[model samples]
Target: MLSTSTVVITSFRNVLALSVLIRVGLILYSEWHDARSLVKYTDVDYRVFTDAAQFLLHPGPGSGNRAQGPLGEGYGDPYTRETYRYTPLLALVVSPNDWLHRSFGKYLFAGCDILNGILIYNILLPQQTRSKATLYTALHLLNPMVFSISTRGSSEAVLSSFVLLTLYAALRDRWTWAAVMLGVCVHWKIYPAIYGFACIAALAGGGRQIRMMTLLKARRILWFGVLSVSTFALLTGGCYLVWGDPFVYESYLYHLHRLDHRHNFSPYFYLTYLTYPSPTVGNFTASTSDASISISWLNDILESPLTSFVPQMTLAIGSGLVFGYHLPKTHLPFTWFIQTTLFVVFNKVCTSQYFLWYLLFLPLILPRVTMSTTKAVLCISVWVGVQALWLSEAYRLEFLGVNVFYRLWIRGLVYVVGNCWVLVQLMQGYDYSYVTRKYVESK
Candidate 1:
């Protein structure tokens, strides 16, 4: 009979091999599909990423002429589906794709997916049994959504690596490394920075009674905050110096004020679509009674992307205040998971890829959640059911060329409400008292 250690080792090895096999198989399939068809199966974002990489590898005065960004600026061309919207540094990271295979970026992201799985396992190992740790890691590694996105050449897997690394470092009390990793995450995608407050709260010894002045004065908090801010500044500032205003606008500001009306998953999608200015019609809405019915005032009030920021900020800050402050380092993932979910739910522009922002932390959260098997399965089904409902409408709109805007909008509302209820259930099942007891024991 195999010893416990041997069993543990065998389990780890099996999961690791399974992870590699799954990712490689999907990566090859994606590459093959893309090569065989004019209508590629890989994300259009992959094309943009490769174009940006090619531009980086061969920098020339004419580089700007190759593609135009969403704003008609260079380095990304929406017409060709090459709209590079991420930081230029990401382009530089994948620049090797110029000489390497076009699938190189996919491989890179897949590798990060593997690394993220390892990180998640290590982060949980100290608090969980070896068997449970391995299972949780397998949950992340074998997650179909994660591997599919990475194999399609999306960078969310890479972003998740940094996110998990930051989480791991914070749990280990390596504030400097955590800060630096978080800075990289923010550089890769701006949304990850929303968890900064949670990290600070964790560092200052999370608890509701912890005074604001105490957090402000905590040396670790100060160091982590300063380093994260400085690292982000240096990276963005250096990129700005090299790439100029277009980089700044596309990578950062564009997302801040993004009002994308197409292929969105947010509840606000229809509103954005209706309010968005059209080149031919402009912002005017013609009423049946009047030829010139300017609803510009109403549009301005309801349509401003900044209006979404109010709720998003409220959720972000509120999550930190409520969960982050109360949870110890052991439970930080719960704080992050809730914060990201709320942010994406309320954001003016959301996409399917945005789901990964919170999904990466779900494994860490599950170990402490007290849901029954039936309840857990029910929650998962409801969450996935709403997504399927939205996707059915989306398929009609995108593929069938049918106008399902109202149906899609109604589905979006269902999606958001379903997700919120799921979150509530998850929170209710979480062992908050366990976290409190752990903290008290440590004290």
Candidate 2:
């Protein structure tokens, strides 16, 4: 009879093989279904990506031509009318898909998911048993959000792969590599810039130290800042040189002034909607085209009394400083998880794709943390459950032509509450023993 260890290892290998096969099979199915459709029922963002790629490869004044101006007007093609808000790097990444079918991009994103799974497994190998690491990898591969986003060609998968790689580099004490990867991620999407502070905090040693040690820490932080900024400048500056101000305006500034009043997953959406309810069209309801509605209330909130900028900046900076200070006192992986989570929670927009930013890291940290399996499951379930409720209301409004703003607002409130509760649980359950021991040893 085989020993228990041998049997366990064999079983794990089988599970790993099966998981890969299933993921690949699902991806192929999605590609096939999308290809066979007469209308091509993929996400609109995918079409936007393809259109941007086409325009980049063949600049023209006809169909799929690039648009200009703040509203991104002046395009014959509706899809291409809105300028691509993502970095030029994403356009370059998707440019090759112009020759191939759109499903190819989805395939590439699926491949990214696979790569992320592998990275997660390897990242955990040093701190976790092979069996536990394998299980974590499987959990990541099987996550429903991962499947939904990757199959739909969302860039979150690619962005998340960069984030995991950055974390992996940081854990290995490869600060330069971490900085480079982070710069690349920030170029792809601006949100990952928050993690840079976490990286700096991780590198900065913990505890009240002597003046000389403080100086050394300051020097190291300065070095990291220079490397990261230089890397970011190289990538973005090159883009600026090539594409000029339009790229900068559309990619960066547009997001800053974005006024998305649509009923998405954001709690802020409810506040905006309640303050500035959408006007009813003849028989239809509030939609994107109904831009005639007055946004004076939102404008006032953003510009007067307290100014939205003040609170947003304060929350962002305050959270970063607090997390950075405590990061050295908590497990790196868990603290990174909380840092990303808090950033999303405090963001101006919290879409489903945004959740993918931190969900991919859940399995890697969950296995290493001290949180009980039951509580972890409960927390994840509640988080996902509230999101589902909000999505249902969104589907009703967007797809079924039903006006459910009231229901959506209620669900959004619940969703926000659920996220806050989960965040609290995560903080309470985080394992600080590693950092505590390190501090003790240093002293």
Candidate 3:
């Protein structure tokens, strides 16, 4: 007799098989290069590997002088020193691991995957009814992206998993506990904090104001704000107090000005339209030896809104309009999802890592929140495919030529359309919803 779990486990195996194939190619290529030929560890794992290096674990003239990374030192020393930039509070929760990094660093990094996977699976399980939770957890466990995060020990996984818990708590009407999770998750990654607005939207739904006089007159928002601020203050202050600034702790902060980066497939890709002729790759590469070529889209994404911030004001107004209209209708937890995707798509820099930021949310979107589970999976899988294709060497051929990367362009268009499909699914009113509907109907 086949149990329901068996069937879902089988499906998970299928996804796992596909994931193995997708990665086997990369592994084979790496193996194809021997010790003499291999350059250095690149790909998403490099960042996580390096992020760990940046912490107290690294012992070279720094915290413990242990020398960071399993094989090397610092995020960018042999590579480049890009700081791990999150608000101060984030460094606190994982401080235990930070301390444990010296002896257990390798294992600590390994355990990050274990911890996150366990949390995501169990947290989402009860939310899904009628045998869906098992399937959901199995799929998550098998997702190549999840495997990738675990392998590198990406801290984004830590933050994203926390966000899921926060959302789950809110859905359960455990609002205070939800606040605790939100405050903490935001402390780690500012991106998920956008969900707070979603929570507010949830509160403000359907022809009614969400004004609980206690929430306002009692200064509930103010108190929460203070609590959040204090928690961050303590964590960041304490960590830096011990480990102190490692090195080159600025790249993450510098991103606001790093418009010219070729990574991140944002709308900035269009900048090539106006600037390619001036310093074409042929000439640019001739003059500069290493890493000379860059997509022209950088200037446009970074250039607009330079004058007195009118552009930002307009953007805020437009965003306000979207929220104001949608707040009364669409579920709010997803509102930030729409905002993040739109900005990433239309803006200038859409890095591969950025995809994980949203991928973490799909489980919430699936089986009930918006699209059918199959469609939700498909929507996510398409973007993942686009990324996988882009990461292959074949992309570097045509991509490195025109600066436009024709294949990537075509893929981008597909992504835009797919993105719109989900946005509409989430933005429009209807119920394939589980938690969101419960949140509204309860009030």
Best by TM-score: 1
lDDT tens digits, residue span 347-429, model 2: 65677777777777787667545777899899989988998888888888788877777678788879878998998887677
- Minimal lDDT window, size 10, model 2: 70-79
Tens digit per residue, CA lDDT, model 3, 77-108: 31122344443233333344434542232234
Error of 3 at 320 (Å): 9.6
Candidate 2 displacement at residue 349 in angstroms: 1.9
**lDDT winner between candidates 1 and 2:** 1
Clashes of 3: 12
Models ranked on TM-score: 1, 2, 3
TM-score of 3: 0.64
Ranking by lDDT: 1, 2, 3
Q: List ranges where model 3 is wrong by over 4 Å.
A: 3-110, 121-127, 172-177, 202-218, 236-252, 272-333, 369-394, 397-414, 426-443
Going through the candidates in the order shown, the clash numbers are: 2, 0, 12
